[model samples]
Target chain A: MSNRYEARFSAVGGQGVLLAGDILGLAAQKFEGRYSLQSPTYTAQVRGGPTKIDVIIDDEPVMYPKTTAINFFLSLAQGSYDAFLYDLRDDAIVVIDPVLVTKWDEKYKTYQVPVIEITKTKVGKMIMSSVLSLGIMIELTQVVSKEAIEKALLQKAPKGTEELNLKALRTGYEEAQKLLAQET
Target chain B: MSSASSEKSDIVFWQGNEVVARAAIAAGCRFYGGYPITPSSEIAAVMAELLPEVGGTFIQMEDEIAAMGTVIGASLVGKKSLTATSGPGFSLKLEHLGYACIAEVPCVIVNVMRGGPSTGLPTAPAQADVMQAKWGTHGDHPTIALAPAFHREIYLDTIKAFNISEKYRVPVIILIDEVLGHMSEGMIIPDPSEYEIIDRVKPSVPPEEYNPYDTQYGDVPPMANYFEGYRFHVTGLNHGANGFPTTVPDICHNDEVRMIQKVMKDVDTLTEYDEYMLEDAEVAVFAFGSTARGAKMAVEKARQEGLKVGLFRAITLWPFPEKVIHELGQRVKAFVVPEMNLGQMILEVERSVHKEMPIVGVNKVGGVPVPPYEILEKIKEVLQHA
Candidate 1:
């Protein structure tokens, strides 16, 4: 457990949580040269129900792929935040969308970033919120290098949307930097 | 054979289903006929996108049965063919599965198993199909099934599945749990020189003299493709040396015996297993597919506490590897079989070892994987009882 870092990205289906988790896992393996496994759980319905993807990254080969101890977590909806906050280390970092997840737990280190709002105003696409949240999650946890995440994001981004997706990512990253600066 | 697709880098992150398609193409599989089904749908999707690029054919049939029948038809034409499905789809394909069996058609079927007696849990993982793969088809038929634990093994085994099917002229089933199907992980593409690729043995006799089921060529007859200028009868009925159906007691009996013997006689070569720290162990955990992941971690944790525990993973689920289990039972105090299904393969463990040692199963259903802690607890409990 100590050798591996586990994270869960959760939201309602079609929120791009799966894609965000996929890109993060890809970055961990392809760019950062670490071992990673990503798996998702969702309802049979195509959309609307809560969905979550669990990612485990380790230096050594990951023998057990599922999450035992979550090191970092991000929830983009209230229902997700309430349902999926489990098996976390005492000091696990939690990132949430302040607008979507109104309720909060003060026990763990939490960052209230308006990821959806950032995507709507700056990125101009609601679907890009997951990408923005990924930027904030990476910055808050520093699980993977910024360069690695950016590279993976560009590779996975749809054709003709690379520049827009990068903007959303940088905006969220800058927001995270500001939050860290305030703490300092 | 190599997964040399430009879309796949030397080392890349890929879903388990995606690698199956990649490996199939690399193994020279030229025809894919499958219906879209959850978990296993990615295999068809990848095959559809890549097969055309390789001059292969991808057909989406009306139903799972037709999907299977299409693969059989394609394979009969000498194209290495494949089909993939999960749960209910797998059940529907059984009709053709048996047809492929007695007809001696060489093709691969990938069943990314979801929870089910009848679509029990479509989005969940379960290993309940252990017996189904072996005995689902009516009448007695030889079965060769492979269960792979990791993404890398999925690639290697998918290739091996086709090779085994071709070598023995039998349908090979690859049983993958839904978790393994949906999970994405990193693996390096294997080099072409690293592995051997096997093709079916074609007949050298003239077209007029060729016999598809000629026993003179030994247990496995030299097969000639349908349109390869050698036209011979192929049917699910009991076949004689001349490839025609026979009702004679001796001919029918010999056909049935040879069908099963073709696999049983070569069990040693067909068996692929993984043993971890079994030497000088008091207990052994028998597991496969995704369940093996948990069992492996439990063994490691048990080892750290100085427990004499080990893991025996059955990569080849059918052709059950009973002899190996029988030998291990003699030395070990007990065997713990953990799977997503409730005690399906545990029965096989009981049969293999007889009553020589105690055998217990840690089973679960309805989506969640059996955690390592649960397996560890069982190991401890079995040790105390043993």
Candidate 2:
């Protein structure tokens, strides 16, 4: 019931998780210090290992960003969700791509965004999955304007592929709307 | 009134580890020797980057022992040196740290503590290293240690650690935790000129007239650097003013006793802590480093919920903050110590405070933090019982 929310992102190390956290941090800082915390847990395994980034953005000063419940949990890979689903808030929303997450409860608020499908269609690369997920997250959060986020992304992301990522995000946004419509 | 180099910047956001390294850089520390460990690796990494940029050197020693040994050696060459590590690494450095103490070598050690006893928790911060920082070495010796709660103090307090080490010619410990080490926030980085950096007093007299261990002239003799063509033996064994081995019970006892007094005499100026809400509260929770950060949040939340809860954080871990602990122990009905390990600092609190009163320990091991809610719960438990 609390308007305060956190987005817990899980993936393997090669999935650009630390980059994702930095991007989220940039977005928050650009949005006037929304009391956001971007804490990432990296294990000893150097590459292709489990990575969890806890991004908690609250309405007030954040003391520590750890909690047993997460309002938004996204698992880019099925293994990520399995490792973290036990701690998800009961009513929390989950968005996983059918291609990435082979099995997911379709009856729940889980929406198979087909993130990989959108990424491949829009950007011709599955690496844009995180970009597309960002689009879905912006559309859902409504905490900041999507345009502001896009601008922030443009300002922050590296040379080249910025526009493509934006388009990929829009694709994820539209696909998420269609999937949610079907679920309702 | 000045040397050659200078820089100016009023304020900037900085990481605790970054500031610790920056402080060392500002303190004329041209040498940084350390092994990499969680929550503390950033300091080593930063020093690796910053040191060479300014004509200094950084080495990733094989272990903490070598790290401490090299820093001491580097200090004798008239270079300010430092090392940073956590619990396991801190333990490893203790033997040589005692070496630095007995030899009266001035160097700074930054301990970014995590949960411990072993490789307890790498990421989570804990304040359980308080007692360890004080008594980690084997024998009776004066130790100068400071704990900084915020990123800003990590920089300023590091300067303090360097000053104490240089002034007293002993190892100074800058005790922080994993939380502070990694936590980044906005801070004011003072201009280099605004702070006074102290260097060890070097011998003005000729090399032939020097006495390395002389206790006559205010206990610290002038140390001429190797570059200046003055070389003297530095030993771990008790030596005369001439720096030679001495086993006479009187000479050894006097040397060791005088070394401890050099820092203990000024312990008043070294002890730094912040106490909040304790004057009126019957329950005060004692914590430090990351746990103190948690305790602050918990105390504020409890106050909003109409509970009179106080917080006491030890900024100076060594020589113990007994004054604050003793004073609060009498006024407060109970003392709650929340930390990462199982009652490392609580034992010290118990020893300092009146044992007749309630002294509860909030401990969590296995590399996790003692959560704010758990501390709040202990506060409630104490209040109800009181």
Q: What TM-scores do the predictions have?
A: 0.96, 0.87
Q: Give DockQ per model, in order.
A: 0.47, 0.17
When candidate 1 is compared with the true two-chain complex, its DockQ is: 0.47
lDDT of 1 at B195: 74
Task: Quote the true-contact fraction of every model.
Answer: 0.45, 0.05
lDDT of 1 at B148: 97
The lDDT for every candidate, in the order shown, is 0.89, 0.76
Q: After superposition, how far is residue B360 of candidate 1 from its true place, in Å?
A: 1.0
lDDT, candidate 2, at A138: 68
lDDT of 2 by residue, B1-386 (tens): 12112111233434578889988888788999999888799899989999998999899988889998999889888889999999999999999999899888889998888876688777777776777888889998888788887766677788878888888898999888766676554445766776788888877778888888776678666666766766788888778778889888998898888988887787778788888887788788888776787787788778878898889988887778776788778888888888777888788788888569889988877666677888899889988988
Most accurate candidate by DockQ: 1
What is the DockQ (computed on Cα atoms) for candidate 2?
0.17
Off by over 4 Å in 2: A1-5, A58-61, A86-93, A102-111, A124-128, A144-156, A159-184, B1-16, B120-128, B182-196, B216-222
